[model samples]
Target: MDQAVLPLSPTEQETSLGSIVPPHTADAYWLTPYGAPGAWSTNTTYIVGHSWEGRASPFNNISSLSQPGDVLTVTTAEGPVHYKIDRVTTEYKDTLKDSAIWDKAPGRLVLITCFMEDLGGKNIIIQASPLPAA
Candidate 1:
């Protein structure tokens, strides 16, 4: 896949991270180590995107997809990964949803982006879980 949409390798960023590590990307998808890709345990995996209202990026509309039970697909080197939207909410930058963001079961995904309405203060979060084997 082209990194123009995501990074091929982790690009270094001057950031302060408490867990695993932040994914590298100038304008691509970030796969944080909050949870292992295939690990379906109580550890939450976090993927984040930049919320550019008019920018052409996958996460640009992260805030606008406000329907529950929707599906989000991620194509990786291994194969396609699928998850179903379980929750979506706006959380103040100060008051984050602990249970929703961390210590999650395996096969779960957490997507975060800057809140367009909050002027970069709050975050729009999306939570999804793996689909049942078909």
Candidate 2:
């Protein structure tokens, strides 16, 4: 797809992982399907994208180069919200739920993407807490 990831709300009954978490296109980033944005609450905001091999994807940096202290800003209709990285790790794709990154606790940003060129082989997770007052 040529379109980029856009931030939009999902349907109330949107529980299918396919529908809730659309396949990442070359141009777009997908926000979490359930949680409200960090601006709305201390709640977590999840985002997933693909690390398109040899291509420019929105999350390529996060997948390949991000560190524990790096900063990321996500701009929503509410405005720009800042997040300070707290953790970065790699996990096998199938066991993502077993990781602490799935916590429903407040005040978190989870950036998930394919590890290297393998979409299902591995995943790199970046967890961050919302910076004080974006």
lDDT for every model? Answer: 0.59, 0.66
Per-residue lDDT tens digits of candidate 2, residues 31-131? 54546556556557777667777788766756557777788876667777788888888888666656666567686777777777676688888888788
Backbone steric clashes in candidate 2, count: 5
Clashes of each: 3, 5
Report the C-alpha lDDT of model 1 over 4-102, residue by residue, as the tens digit.
Answer: 333323334422332222243335555543454443435665666565555555555566765578877766566667778888888776556443475
Q: List the RMSD of every prediction in angstroms.
A: 4.6, 3.9
Candidate 1 lowest-lDDT run of ten: 13-22
Provide the lowest-lDDT 10-residue window in model 2: 14-23
Task: Write down the TM-score of every candidate.
Answer: 0.69, 0.76
